[model samples]
Target chain A: MAPLIEVADLRTHFFTDEGVVKAVDGVAFTIPAGKTVCVVGESGSGKSITGRSILNMVPYPGRVLDGAIRWQPDGAPPVDLLALDPKGREIRAIRGKDIALISQEPMAALSPVHTIGNQMIETIRLHLGLTKADARARAAEMLAKVGIPRPKDRLDSYAFELSGGMRQRVCIALAVACGPKLLIADEPTTALDVTTQANILDLFRELRDALGVSILFITHDLGVVAEIADEVVVMYLGQVVEQGRVDDIFHRPLHPYTRALLGSVPRLTRHRPERLPTISGMVPSPFERPSGCLFHPRCDRFEQGLCDRSAPELDRYANDRVARCFKAGAGS
Target chain B: MLTYILRRILFMVPVTLAISLVAFIIIQLPPGDFITALTAQMAENNETLDPETLAALRDRYGFDQPMIVQYWKWITGIVFRGDFGQSFEWSRPVADLIWDRLGLTLIVSFATLVFVWVLAFPIGIYSAVRQYSWGDYIATFFGFIGLAVPNFLLALVLMYLSSRYLGASVGGLFSAEYVNADWSWGRVVDLLNHLWVPVIVLGTGGTAALIRIMRANLLDELKKPYVELARARGLSETRLLLKYPVRVALNPFISTLGWILPTLVSGAVVTAIVLSLPTSGPLLLNALFAQDMYLAGGFILLLSILTLIGTLVSDLLLAWLDPRIRYE
Candidate 1:
């Protein structure tokens, strides 16, 4: 059977005044039901772009150029979503009903004028056709499941009255209210403080267990990937450089950029003497993408002629791991 | 919001007082006095300019006193006794003349407003939803024509069309036959038909302007993140765009009340002359030409107050409708 959601060779670009920004270039990933996958990248690495492309929410001047996102509904026909006319596919029907998204900023993400109850009721009614009373009851239940206290009273409160942590919980409740099969959380907990972040992450685990929903999480923090992701896809300059089972990728990483990423992450078990190993230089822009192996200029093992000018495709190695760098396992 | 409104109402008192003082001062600055204009006809008839008769006329009008004393008498008489001195041009009290013309102007102004809003809202929402489509292009194309064709020119075209094709006559609030007839359905119908042309000519430009504002606001509102959330939640286009952001989008257009009185004044002027209706526009123009300061000043004062009230009404409405706003 086809994977529940399959995205292949996706490229999205924004036509800005300076030039066309290759926001997402050649990104590919998949997630099966009852599983979790996380896309890890630095700022401008196209993780968010990849997530937005799945829903075709990328705005004007930035459009999905080349990609196919196929969804095999649990019991429905396999839909080649890219080929489906926007109105014909009713892509929106699948969004809140089957695939929900939580954005980065909770405050901006939540509509200020609406009460939590109002927003939740609107979504539930649209997707489930639940009566107002039934939808309200279910909304409260979902809110409690997301660890919001006093869900009944809090329902009547406007978004402004809620704390950042509570707003995040409300957003999570809104996303999962209809019991969607997949949740696309794009840095959903990034705005919360440490304590709230931990609680929200734990809530995610609990909710996942209760609903059997898959989550395609996107974030820049490696620690978050380690905490919740079952599998990890590392992206750089719109291309996937490494991907594998979480444990394999963490313990026996085979790619240079992945190593640099892991090195830069400040682990709790730290006794730094002089310098924290950092990834030097900036990510290249779309127009100035390196001639070969996009990370070649920034790679520590820079071989002048061999590494700088030759692009390498993804090469699979032992243990079902794939790395794009030519010097994955060998030191330069 | 109620407290804020009350405070604004209280603040208007001092502002109005200052306006009244300025009006009195400017009206006093003219070279010849009111009695001089009053007796000009007698002088034109080659009679002696009688000093004693002029003094008695000035004393009766309270113009014989010093400027500040006369101003004090006028202000007090109006504020305390509800008396605006007689109009030299119309041979009626200033207040009575305003009372008669005020109702006619208001009815026309209000009818025009209703017509414009009703026409603009749906067209604007349509254009925003299918922004570059044929429907939008058609609406915007007609909108450009409406905006570019001055109200006066449109009024002329409408009058010509009605008279030439429909055998109608350009006229006032009601037809000559309807003036003597009782308020029956047929007379009311004829009156409405006569009123329709002026309303359309004046309202078309207003509707076009409002449509542009609504389209821009709706487009901006649709780009907001909350709108995205609404879309992601499977809310239909109708619900998402209209329900979630309608109020946010309307605030700017509604808040644009700062200049509506001037717009109304301009509209009334054009409609009054083009429609040949007896609104204050023609009256004021005639007054200015004949140097009738009493009628002109009173008309200007009434227009100024209407402008202030229009802005106040808009602010009150915005405050009530948008919950996100706070007085503090």
Candidate 2:
């Protein structure tokens, strides 16, 4: 079957006074149906911008410069989202019904003044063409489905009345209330405590299984990627540096950036050290990005002349994996 | 919620007393009583005041009573008989004098307030939503002009323009024929025809200030993650803005209700004087200048009470709109 969505050469940029910020430059990926594809990156790696671009909700001062996001819904013809007007009805129709999103901060992601049930029911009624009463019933059922206790009573409660965990659960319930085919969770568990984070991850897994929803999960934590992702896409400096099955990437990593990212993860099974390993140097500012390989300045295995002289395209290696480095898998 | 309202009402008693006490003390602080000022004025005019007449004047108004006793009399008179004492200048009950013009002042002030909100709300939303765009910049520039120019100056300019071009008298709350006339549809229509000048003059400054505040508040709210969350959920842009950020931005505006009432009555003093409008503003000012204690003090008391009521109304509204404050 064709992938649920195909994003090709996506380049989202912000035109500021100083210079253009290449927030997401020449990015490409696909999310297959019913699978969780986690995009792992540090801050400014453009993961969040990429997710926002899919919904055509890039804020002011920024615009999607070039890209083709071909969305192939289960029974409908493929739609080119970039071709549609960002503020027009055709794109709007695809945003909430076909795709939904949950963000990092639950406290900041729910409108404080509105009741949880009102927000949920609004989305359901908007897309599903249901009566207010039916929408309320569906919202309560959605809340219960997401493990919110006493969903009927909780319906009247405002977002401010709930705890952080409960708010995130409400956000999840809201996202899945419309039965979207795709859900983009942009670091949904980052603001959560450890226990709540686990529960939320478990909830995502349950959602994918029960609703057959494809998830484009964005996070900077490799541990979370390991816990929830079926496929992993590692990004560095606005470009996809590596992509493969989760086990393939974790067990036999290819890209040096991916290897370094894995090395930086704090392991519970390993012996203790005074200082944990960290990826050397900072992610360069978008305006001051280095020539050739963006990671060459910080790569431990950098080839002095070749890596700095020319950029290497993503090369397929072994079975069904791609890495941007010329020396893929050589270090291992 | 009922208990909260009840608690607020109970608290108003001591607050009202405190305000009244302070007002009385301030009124008495300047110098000797109105009798002294009157005698001085009479002497300046080379009029001889007979001692017997002076003593009788003092006796009639109870000026011979102690300060505490005088304050007690004033408070009790209001509490028991709804009388605000006698206006020393007009020689009538303060209540009767104030009621004569209070209705017109209220209509003018209320109309101005409604105009301010009606103009500010939409422009504020647009300016914030389209920050840095040409439309936003134009509104911002004009808003600053409104704030910087005094209302009296604006009133003068408006008066000049209206008389110069429109051939309409832009002064007072009514035409000459309707001055002190009984209420009628024709009178009301005349009042409205003459109303816009004062309303525009008085409301401009507040409208400018409120627009800036609304824009800033909504800007802050727009940057919040919830706005993005709502947008990502496919909410139409217009609905998202009005339902979320604008609602939050309206808090400060509602809280300003108490401050706005006194301003509605008092802040227009200079504007009223300039426009020659028959509002409480000029009356209060003239009374204060003449040391007409009952008239001045009554206006102050009435205004203070209005402020308290405005605060109570805003508090109730806040509790209704924001769930976080409902129980507390």
Number of the top-ranking candidate, with DockQ as the measure: 2
Per-residue lDDT over B256-295 for candidate 1, one digit per residue giving the tens place of the 0 to 100 score: 5655556666556866776878677888777665556567
**What class would a CAPRI assessor give candidate 1's docking?**
acceptable
Model 2 TM: 0.98
lDDT assessment of candidate 1: 0.81
Per-residue lDDT of model 2, residues B172-244, tens digit only: 8889999978999999899889999998999999999999999999999999998988888788888888998
- Measured as a fraction from 0 to 1, the native contacts recovered by model 2 come to 0.74
| Leading candidate by lDDT | 2
Q: How far is candidate 1 from the true structure (C-alpha RMSD, Å)?
A: 3.7
Fnat of all models, as shown? 0.55, 0.74
lDDT of 1 by residue, A160-208 (tens): 8888988999999999999898899999889999899898899888888
lDDT of each: 0.81, 0.89
